[model samples]
Target: MTLRVYLFVFKSRGYIHIVNIFNQMSSDGVTKYKYEYIIVGAGTAGQTIAAGLPSKDVLILEAGGYTTSLLDIPILTPILQKSDFDWSYETVPQPNSCLGLRQQRSRWPMGKGYGGSQILNNMIWNVGHHEDYRGWFSPEEDYNYERDILPYFRESEAEHQPTILKHRTKLAEAFMNATKEYGYDDSFKVPHLTQRNGKRWNMAHENHENNLSHHLVLNAFVMHLLFDRTSINRVTGLVYEKNGFEFEILATKGVILSAGAIGTPLILLSSGIGPKKELINTTVTFRKDLPVGHNLQDHVTTGLDLILLNDTLGMRPWEVFTLNSFYQYFVNGDGPLTMNGCEVVGFLNSTNKSKNWDLGFMVLPIGASADAGIHFKQILNIKDNTWSQYFDPLTSQQSVSILPILLHPKSRGQITLKDDVILIDPKYLTHEDDVDLIVTGIRIIEQLIEMPSMRRLGAELNPKPFPGCENYEFASNAYWKCYVRHLTLTAFHPVGTCKMGSSDDQSSVVNREFQVIGIENLFVVDASVMPNLPSGNPNAAVAMLAKKFLSVLLQSHREKPTNYDI
Candidate 1:
């Protein structure tokens, strides 16, 4: 059992050997360490880069703990989010959106363990649109969607398209058929994700064996990024806390923050590289005037529930308590264990003419098991009355749901420093136009249910009025608009805090190559670097983003070996 350890490369008799160190040590009781690359956040993007980066001199600092073998089962994801695997972040109360939710605050749950959200996310694999790829990067940057990124998307997926789902439901079929009238061909086009058979095949799946550098540290919380006092903008070291002990590790090449949208921006602001106004109250000395926490974008949705013909008899209650279910999963790698919440998706643009991959409006299925209502209330922190009205019925009496999502919202929010955690002000439904667009989307869903195929399946809108919307009739457009506001929920897709663009763009935080503006040896390579949020779920896109950055990093290193320096 040979363990690949990371310290530094040494040439002995014309051979490079990696020396394993329990901890870099000296008689001083504390050890000083240096790596070529230090990546913050062992989330989806961080692990991807750490697994593929050519250099063995890399260290990944994950704020949370390690990902255990339990993450391999898809259904256990819900349980994981409530456990220590989650960062357990909640947003500040919103004045506009989430009027029906508890305290009107959106709870932002991010995976804190090694695999990040990939271990806990609803496993849906989607490579957004061609225009989305162009939109996400700066115009001057040559990011070839087909040549560079698309192939990687294909490389990672073992896609089980919605049409072939073995556990297909009648409601899902009806949803697919109903959308055809509105020019949506495949309402049943949900794409299964980073899984092979029934197990999760995330970016961190094979990482244990092949990671060239075993420099990955879990249970390690990065307190602050250390820079040379001699060169204020030149990032040179990282200060992190692990097991109640703190240490500073040096970096020779650079530091990358793939710590996710929320975690990344907070680190940047704390490191004194965000907007001057934002850092005014913080103790961090302002390093650059970049808008590190502005342009925060997320995909919000308005849900429309339904009552299935079988009276929810066919619903697979999110059950994991039995030995039979465990035996079924362990022996065959199939059954309820393989299900990743929802099993179908219907992606659409407003015009109803864009390519299938393009995003605009999504009528996606959010699997409604018997126990799902309980999970939603706990995970989303829904109010008791709100739960009784909206989701509680879906428990045993009703099942299957389609949420009309606001794919691109004009509304923007900001992330600021809290005492320890980051403050997320999603400002959901703040933009008037965003609310209007989603109303139009719900109308389409209302019409879709009227289609003969859907109607035959008894797929009718749940008649109960939402808790606060007792004034308007459920059938009216005005009622739906109010519904959108009351039930506004994120697709859990957040991006664009550290936007990428050329220096000419004042709002830009990082350049096309993903380098921070005015800061040397500092880069951000996660969803936060997206100039624009893609029109679809961003898990797969985040992985591709890591691949693209790794290619760039490697290529740049080859082109100018010793020049990626301050």
Candidate 2:
């Protein structure tokens, strides 16, 4: 059955500002300043949860406004980054990686608009292997993957049928064949994406007639949680700023933090619910101190390192802008515009173990150098010297790139606040093991290029040695390691900040049920709650989490009906 997916429809009476809500009074003459549940951050999880519950009893407070139609195109995902729709966050300069980027800081573009990071993502619907989620819970836990997780994934797939790329480039086809040649029998295939008829299909798109339409409040920046007056430990509601006006709204039953990994931890720290050492300097009154922002993890890749120059069969940047292509896109929803940057996905086992898909190769049909330092070079934050010296000669060339993403990195980092500034530090490749794995991945790609499928396309590697690694012998282990250090980039899959674990786990901020460890009536359900980074894109997994949590929420409401009273 195709699931009923709701869109964010902005109607005249649908949205209510904090000032307007103040005017709404109860029949008893008291101001109606309450809801049964208040969900912070109307991103992926917020939208999913709000749509599942009774709309009248729920409210979604999103900091950013709604998105535009122009942003709905699948191929336009690249341009959306660093734009107004993006939060445009940058990490603290990494000592070991991101050496090729400008300022030595990796750019982290999170979605600021309605759909959240879904707006900025490649629309890749990768749920990852079952073992990834199965390991999230302790062995003694009652969580079953078939009963709990798989249903949501199936439901999501039914709702948004993955768009097929009928005009996939020859290079993309060869990538799959190469994967099979490399002994990954299960890895040769096109990636499933959250798109329909070549356009992006997110929760914010077009089905707003549902109950969730009226409950959403755009531009409502949640400042802090409003604790219950009688018991300071339990949260009742929150104070949010909208149009420079701060207003308080109460949630009688629960206040859920659906903000992404970075936003969730930042909010917790500001509300004095994180490590006391980090909160000591802040003005927020100390509440329940937990390790909120520790254990930060993200999937880092050797950015566009395996450059494939296929002269006969690849798409160039200029070729995508023709009038015919635009007409085909708008009229038929089938054209060059339908190309999601990473058209094909292949997995490899770095440890040479069967069924352990540790390294993922996200095959991009167009190389960053194919644009000649115009569009992709700037978007990826490649350094001026690197672009001019290495990629300028390959302007508008027919090329492909198979980026090696470290599925699970041993390296860890933390997010902390210094004087209210959100300090993001995802220390990419700090561990020696992560470097070794990436080097192994590069070796696999090198082998894939030599396969008959790739060789038939006249595929050749870009021999330009990276700017800082010119001294080392080309393609040596030492040179590739240096290349990885210089060109490392994030896949933008940040998670595990507010880790969910058993009560005995000291590092846990949330319990197995997603409730804050020490705080009642407060829950966190987003990427922040993930204990480990999944093997692939996390959007689908997060949606499944919301669905799983929705069942838990409904059961709670049924068991204790009076708790939901506003």
Candidate 3:
């Protein structure tokens, strides 16, 4: 076999010829590189875009490394949190919420490695409600749920369709029955999981291991984009760190930032491309004065307090370590380990009308007390005093938790750069309307526990008064609001920090084509570009958005070949 080595000089338009790597020498004996396209953050969106584009000309830079087989198990999701695979970020203290959590700060865990959050997230597959797409674009824009969005969702799933649970627990079935008995008609159903053959699956896992390995660079943490010295409004390439050495690489066509809601903004802010005031006194020069980290929103859930003492309908926490469970999982790919604890999901309207779902219910087969306050309490950062006074006495109890989640919270928070550290404050439950919705959800849960389907299984709300809110009368709105304040936690679906909107819309960072409004060759394709949070888990929607962006990008190239030529 003969080795063929070729080199090309990059131009303002595009490359002269295609080569795997372009090398340039400087006085320091350092090598430089360039690519047709450079995508930052090899997470869900980054992998999706890479899979669609020509892999040979594209390059992916991931801050973290690859994942192992042990972390791929669906049941091992919670253990992945705070681990090496997780970014393990935390929010600044909130005065209105997280009163019962340690230090009053909410723990924010974003994935760090190859698959990004998909490597650690509970692999639930949901496309979100159709109404969530309304008004996202202008009337003239050729984008809508049926015309553009739905087809992309279908196209993204064409290769790897979402898998249904083969072996569901008793508690999941009971929650389904309870929804029916509570007067909702056939609206609630089992969630589709992002799994194949009872194991976790995502595009990042498939493409990286099989096809895109040549294009990916793991353990490469992107520092900031390198702006063209002549034109500050344009980005030519980016600088990244790997093995404690900084490397600069150029992109001829464009650079995409799929660095997630938190990572993307942190990158832009570090590069001095944020609000005018935020970039002042920073080390880097300001390029674009836009709202880089404002309009932060997330899905916060209440009703962790809604516990059911169901002796006949709960999964034993220790059963996962049993021989039979392991045998069944390894042999037939069916067992308790296949389930991600969240076996049942339901959508409901707080007004009791059959219009749209504003509240979502996720039923776990076990409660916080199931593990005797070991995993759940630690993962959620529940206060020590709250755990001892409230949940410790009921240790190892067979119980179920029906968590009520707010789909569209009016309350908004922000992510800001303070002293070089990313300060995240979701401002959960800052709006009184958000509080009323949780109370409404709690009342629905009250009605649900009384249903014949739940009652037959000995389902009853745990009567323990929450540690911080004992002064108010039990079951009163005042008590429930206080409970909402203390027990509310993020559903892990944060969006809108870099919102997408029309050019006139001041809150928007990117336009309809996923390009940043004020900059050229800079695009954002992640949950951060969402104008509003999707009505459910955002992973599927993120996948769909990636698919749609691929089409839009390809179309833009076809319309203007010279601009995108490689």
- lDDT tens digits, residue span 1-566, model 3: 00110111112012211110121111121233978789998877888898887546788888776666655767767766766567888888989999999999898888987888888787788877887776565443454678857888898777458888766876667768888877788667888888877888888777856766446777677889988877788888899987668899998888999999999999999888889887887776788888989889888886663675646442555556567877877888888778887887878777755345789888887777655655578778899999898877776566667888898898999999877888998998899999899788888888888888777778888788898899999889999999989987988988888888887778889888998888888999999998888887998888888888998888887888635422
Candidate number of the best lDDT: 3
Candidate 1: list runs displaced more than 4 Å: 1-32, 135-144, 147-166, 181-183, 186-188, 304-310, 316-324, 352-369, 418-421, 563-566
The runs of at least 3 residues in candidate 3 whose Cα sits more than 4 Å from the true structure, single-residue gaps closed, are: 1-32, 140-143, 312-314, 352-355, 563-566
Q: Score every model by TM-score.
A: 0.87, 0.91, 0.92
What RMSD does each model have against the real structure?
8.9, 6.8, 9.7
- Of 2 and 3, the candidate ahead on lDDT is 3
- Give each model's whole-structure lDDT: 0.70, 0.77, 0.78
- What lDDT does candidate 2 reach at residue 104? 83
lDDT (Cα) of model 3: 0.78
- lDDT at position 23, candidate 2: 26
What shift in Å separates residue 422 of candidate 3 from its native position after superposition? 0.2
